[model samples]
Target: MMRVLAIGDIHGGLKALVQLLNKLEIKDGDTLIFMGDYVDGWSESAQVIQFLIELSEKINCIFIKGNHDVWCEEWLRDGSVDMTWYIHGGKETMESYSGFSKEDKQKHLAFFENLKMYHLDNKNRLFLHAGFTSMHGVEKEVFQTTLYFDRTLWEMALTMDKSIERDSELFPKRLTHYHEIYIGHTPTTNFGVEKPMNATNVWNVDTGAAFKGKLTAMDVETKSFWQSDNLPCLYPNEKGRNKD
Candidate 1:
């Protein structure tokens, strides 16, 4: 069977991504969904993007755009620099590409510029880099950017009031739109969760590869998961946004 595999934020941990992909033993026919943040935090941002581009040639790939990716596109394509991005790991991403040629850089720019904000499958499952405010579907252009930044959707799941009727207006539409929702912007480590977490049918797969933690990949059908070791261990000499 061609199982759907969803991966968390990579943050440019090429080694970790490789290790997790090995564990998944992914086949050419399988569909793979990556939750973005592919550049930044780690020291191999350029390598990570290169590997992903190659992998897309072998299997079906769905790439979601993260906030960090937005920062990357701005800097790489428009030569725009925002201090906010620099404060968050953009420096490392730039460093990773410092030696690449203009042609090499353009390839990566094309990849990021074409990333999707949200994706829905025939199974009625939704996948995005962050939260969404509308339940009607991704087509309801209600502050569409929320699909890449909103956290209230996950927060509500973590704090669901079971007393409220599901059919009532008081119920959050964000939680009822799809049969399942997968996201990756908010790190699971922030909530002390070290693995893929499912709350109110929303699955948070970002196990914090950007920080001093592991990278996660999950089978959306079987819920089976694979992970890499603490990424700091994977790259001893390079700092991966875990300066603290």
Candidate 2:
């Protein structure tokens, strides 16, 4: 069977991420799928991206764009988006690369732009940065925006009525076409916490690593999971509280 590792939101916790990856004991053929939120929150965004770039050279790595990643792209393309991004822990990401040159920043921006919205593996599983709703079609989907910042879709999916057929053409049911979906963005309990829940075939793995909660990882094929100890939060008030 293929060994697939589904990791939760990193939120710039490079140290913890490295530790978790080490603990998993990744092998040559193993696939490492990062759910989203790779940067912002902790002070290692640059390091995290660099590490992923290096890892990409060795293994099959899938990086999906998270909301913060989208913000980063916006800030890079147009500086006007900095205010919103800064409020959402973008300051930390910026601070992480204080020493990098303009060229280095541009390189990272290109990497962010290249992130995928979703990954389909042999029709059995799907990996997305954030959950998708029926309102979104595959053709119109934008990885930087829809996959990362669409909270309206998330809420609709979360509060969906169970009595209705999940396969309906409206709401998040459109996602049912895929066997299983692994997503990040909405924290399970709160920031830094990890909870695994199954809605139809959708699986949420955000686990909130930015808010002093644990970073989570799951073996999709084996149904095994791993989590780090609670790490400290960068912005205690915002990251500590649950938005939902």
Candidate 3:
């Protein structure tokens, strides 16, 4: 049977990503939905994007856009750099592209440009880089930025009373929009968890590969997950995004 897997933020950790793919033993029939932040953290951001482009050709894949992806796309298109991005890993991402030709960069730019802001599978499962705010649903969201930057939705889910049923008026309206939600952006490691976390119906898969955590991929059906080695161990000489 085909399995759908959800991959978390990479933050340029190509080594870890490779290890995870090997661990998963990916097959042709499986679908991989990658939550974004594909670049900006490790020393291989450019290489990671290139690798992903190649991987997509061989396997079924869906890419979601993240805030960092937006920054990198801007730089790829116009050489514009966001100062915050530079501090948080953009410098390494730019350096990773040292010898790439204009055409090569253009291809990567197109990859980023084509990424989806969100994906809703036939099962009513929602996947996005971050959260959306519309009480009605993602379709009615007012600010596009909230789709990739909002944290309130996750925060509310985390704090919600588990006993509250979906039919309860006390339950959050945002949580009722989808059968289940899977997201990246806020690392579960931040909450002292090093694995994928599920609160209410929202699953947070970002295990903090950009920092002192592992890269993760969870099978959406079984919730069985696989993780790469700790990112710090994969790149001992690099600080990744944990630098001061």
Candidate 4:
């Protein structure tokens, strides 16, 4: 049977990503859904993108756009750099591409440009980098940034009374549209959890690879997951996003 795995934010931890994939023992029929933030944080941001591009040639992969990707894409498209991004790990990302040729950067730019903001699978499961606000679902979301930046959806799910049924008016309408939602952005480590976390029907897979946590991936059907050793351990000389 084919397995669908939802991977969390990479945040330039290419070493961790590789280790996790090796543990997964990925096969021909597996579908990998990446939850964005592929760059910025560690010293291998550029290398991570290069690897993902190559991996796509041999395996099925779906890439979602995240806030950090937006910053990198803008910089790649032009010379513009968001000061906020620079302070928050963008400097490492920029430094990671120091030796790449202009043509190579263009290819990476195209990859980012082609990423999807959200994906809805045949099973009514939604995969996105972050949250959406519209009660009508992702399609009706008026603000594009909210799709990759909003945390309200997850926050609501986390705080909602578990006893509240979907039919209850007290339940969040925004969540009722999908059978399940998989997202990344807010690190589960922030809540003291080192593994994938489920709040109501939303699964937060970002186990904080950008910080002191590990890179994570989950089999969506079984919720079985695999993780790499803590990113800090993999790059002991580097600070990652922990400097922030």
- Find the number of clashing residue pairs for candidate 2: 4
Model 4 C-alpha lDDT per residue in residues 2-97, reported as the tens digit of each score: 999999999999999999999999999999999999999989999999999999999999999999999999999998999999999999999999
lDDT tens digits, residue span 30-131, model 2: 888988788887778788888888889888898888888887777766665668778777887777788888887788888888988878888568788875
Q: On residues 1-244, what C-alpha lDDT tens digit does candidate 1 reach at each position?
A: 8889999999989999999999889876799999979988888999999999999988899999998898999898878988988978888888889789999989999999999998999999989988876667666848867878888888988888768766789877766678888999899999998899988788999999999879999999999999999899998987788766
Q: What count of clashes does model 3 give? A: 0
- lDDT per residue, candidate 3, 101-179, as tens digits? 9999999999999999999999999999999988899989988889999999889999998999999999988889899
TM-scores of the candidates in the order shown: 0.95, 0.83, 0.99, 0.99
The global C-alpha lDDT for each of the candidates, from Candidate 1 onward, is 0.88, 0.74, 0.96, 0.96
Of the two candidates 1 and 3, the one with more favorable TM-score, higher being better, is 3
Worst ten-residue run, lDDT, model 4?
A: 235-244
Give the winner by TM-score: 1 or 2: 1
* Candidate 2, lDDT over the whole model: 0.74
Worst 10 residues of 1 by lDDT: 132-141
- RMSD value for candidate 4: 0.7
